[model samples]
Target: MNVRVMNAAVAKTVAPDKPAAAAPAHIAATGLAVDFPLEGRKQRVLNDINIAVPKGSFVSLIGPSGCGKSTLLKVMAGLVTPSEGTMTVAGLSPQEAVNARLIGLVFQEATLLPWKNAIENAAFLLMTADETIKKSEAFDRAAAMLKLVGLDGAEKKSPSQLSGGMRQRVAIARALALDPEVLLMDEPFGALDAITREEMSECLLDIWERTNKTIVLVTHSIDEAVFLSREVHVMGTGPARIIETLPITVPHPRTEESYSDPAFTAAENRLRSLLIESHKKGRR
Candidate 1:
C-alpha cells in the first residue's frame, strides 16, 4: 500500500498515552568518550557526549556513519566502557543496570540460536541470566512475550521456519522477557525490506505503548527516527558528539499520515541539515 492508504487504514489505532508527571531521567551521560588503541596510538571514537532520557520515553540517535551512535549505545548497554566521563542508567552504572536486568539490547541482526525453537529462543536470556526463574516459569513468560509480539502460533517453529520479521520478533520477545527498564536498539530493523520495516515500526510502537519502556534507538533512516522518537539527537563525527537534540511533537502512534505532517518534515529536515554540515566539517 502507498503511504496514504496505510495511514488511513491504521489511523483508527489508539495512540499511546502521554506521561502525566515529569518522569526522572533514566539514562544520563556526561562528557562520555571512547577510544581504542591502534598501532601504538589512541583512536578516539566519542568525545564529550551528553544526554538525558526521561523514564518511559522513546528517543533516537541519528547521524552519518562513524558518528559513534552505535558506540554510545554500546556504552549504555555495558558492552563497552567509556574511556572518560561517566554514564548511568536508572541512577546506576551501566554494568550494575545490566546485572540487575534493567537494560536490554537488540542488535542489527536477530542473532537467534539456530537450534532453538521460537519459545526456547525467547526464554534463553531469562533461563541463563536469572537462576531463580524456574524453567517452566521462563517458558510461560517467553510464550506470553512471543504472543505480545504477534507470534502467538509460531512458538514451536525454529528460526529457519520463520521469516526475517518473525525472527526479529523472537529477538524482541526475548528482550522484553527481561522486563527491562531501558531498551537500547542498534539498527534493529536496518536489514529488512521496506514493507517489513514499516510493519516492524508499527509493531514497536505498540510494544512501547503497552510496556512503557525507556528506549534509545540508533538508526540512519530519518523517517524512522522521526516517527518513533519523542526526541531525536543528531551527532557529528570527528571524535563524535551530539550537535543537536530535536524534540518531535508529531504525536503518538504515528501512522503514514505522520510522515507528511509538518512536524515530521521539520524534524527530518533539521536532522538532515545537521548531518550534511557534520559531513562537510569531517571532510575539511
Candidate 2:
C-alpha cells in the first residue's frame, strides 16, 4: 500500500516539522551502562552501549529475553538512570526532555483506565500535566489524536468495551495526545496474537509515516524488527550490549507483500543468525 499522506486537518493538529536530511540525533547514548543491586552487589545489566536515532526515523532493538533491551529503553525514557556515560533526547538529558514533555512512552500492556472512556483516557495526561488546559480543549485535542490512530467513532467506548488491539490504539492515542517529539515503545504489541501483531505493525508504520515522530521500539520478533525499522540494533546478553547495527534497505510504504520481498527475508535471516549466535555465546 502507498503511504497515506497526513490530511491537512491532522497536519494542523500535529504541526510536525518535516525531518531534514541532516536532522540531528533525536536520541543518543554513549558508553551507557546500567546497574542494579543484586544480593547487595552491583549487577551490571548493560555495558558500553552507544546508539544514535536520527530525527523522524524508526528504529528497533531486538535481543534475547534478558538482554536489557527494555532497560535501555527505560534509560532513554528517564524512568531509569544510567550508572555510567551519558544519554540525551533532543540534545537534552533524558530527565530534562521528559520534564519538557518531549518524550512519550508506551509499554507491553495498554494500561488504560477502566473508569474513563476512550477520549477521556486519551486526554488524561494532557489535563493532569498542564493545569492551564481546559477540559473541553483537552478532549477536543484528544479526539483528533483518536482519529489519527483510526479510533474516531469509538471515543465513547470504555476500555472494557475495546479489544486488545483497540485498547492498544487507545494507549497510543493517549501518548500521541502529548504531541511528543519522540515515542518510545517497549513491546507495545507483545500481548497480541500473530495476526493482530501484524495488523498493529502496519498501523504503527502508518502512524510513523504521518507523524514523523522519532520512534524507538523494543521487540522480540525478528520479522517485526525487519518490517518496521529503518535500522535494527541487535543486542547481545552477558553484560548486554549492542553487537550489531543492521540497516534495512527496504524502501518505505512497506506493505504486507514486503514480507516476502528479498530484502525483508535477507534482513530477517541475518537478525536470526545474530540472535542465535549470541545465545550460543551466552551459553558458554
Candidate 3:
C-alpha cells in the first residue's frame, strides 16, 4: 500500500492541513533529538535526527556501542521516549502502535521463562497480546511459529535445554506469534557465536522475505547489516545522528557466497570507514 493509505490507517497526530504527500512516513522522525538528565546537566544521546522507513522495507541501524543505535530502536518501539522531536510508526505514535499490537520487539537476550517450555513460551505471547485466543489455539499458533523459526522438534524443551541459537529462535518465534505488522530488533543475535550469528542472519532473512514485515534492526555488525538490510542507516557518535543511509544493491536470497560478492564487500568497507570516522569523532 502507498504512504497515503498507510498514514490514514495509522492516523497521525500531524496537522490536518498537512497534505497527504507530506504525510507521516511509515516510520519517521522529524528533527528528533533525545537527552538524559545526568548530574543536573542534560546529556544528549541523539541529535537532530531525521529518518523515514518505507513500508515493507528491511532497514538496519549500525554504529559503535555508545552511538545511540539501541536508543533509536527504543524510541521506535516506544520503550524510551525521545527528549525532543516527533516520531511515528506507521503514522501512529509508537505507543499507539504498540498498544494496538501492531509492533513486535526482540532483544539481544532471549528473555524466556526458564520454567516454560518452548511452546508455552511462544504461546504465552500470543495469549498475552490477545486474550481472546483459546489455550489450545494459542499452542497451535505457537507451534506453527516455532516451526517457522526452525525449532520444530524442540517445542517441549525448556530454556535450559536449548542451545543459544535455539533460544534466540524461540524469542523470534514469540515475537512472530503476535503477528505484528512491524518487528523492531535490538542486537537480537549479538550474543551468539560467529557461526550461529551468520546462520541466524540467513534464517532471519528468509523470515523477512516470507513475512514482508517492516523491520528495523540495530546491530554493530557491518556484515550482518549489509547482508540482511535493504539499507543501512549509519550513525555518528557523540549525541549520535545518522551519517548516511547506504543502500545494499546485492541481490536477495543472500547465501554464504553473498559475503564474498564485491557489492557486499564494498558496502561493508564503506560502513566500516564511516564507523571508524564516527569513533574518531567520539574520541576527539
Best by TM-score: 2
Tens digits of per-residue lDDT for model 1, 234-261: 7877767776667788976688898899
Each model's lDDT comes to 0.86, 0.88, 0.86
Candidate 2 lDDT by residue in tens digits, 1-284: 01113212222111112221255778888888999999999999999888888999999999998899999999999999999999999999999998899998898899998999999999998887788999999999999999988899999999999999999999999999999999999999999999999999999999999999999999999989999999888888887987777778777789989999998988888788879988987887
Clashes of each: 0, 0, 0
TM, every model: 0.91, 0.91, 0.90
Worst lDDT window (10 residues) for model 2?
11-20
lDDT of 3 by residue, 169-203 (tens): 99999999999989999999999999999999999
- Candidate 3 — worst ten consecutive residues by lDDT sum? 11-20
> In model 1, which runs have C-alpha deviations exceeding 4 angstroms?
1-22
Looking at model 1, report the run of 10 residues with the lowest lDDT sum.
Answer: 12-21
lDDT of 3 at 163: 96
Q: Model 2 lDDT vs. the true structure?
A: 0.88
Candidates in order: C-alpha RMSD to true structure: 8.1, 9.4, 7.5
Record all residue pairs in model 2 with backbone atoms less than 3 Å apart, i.e. clashing: none
Residue 230 CA error for candidate 3 (Å)?
0.3
* Candidate structures ordered by lDDT, highest first: 2, 1, 3
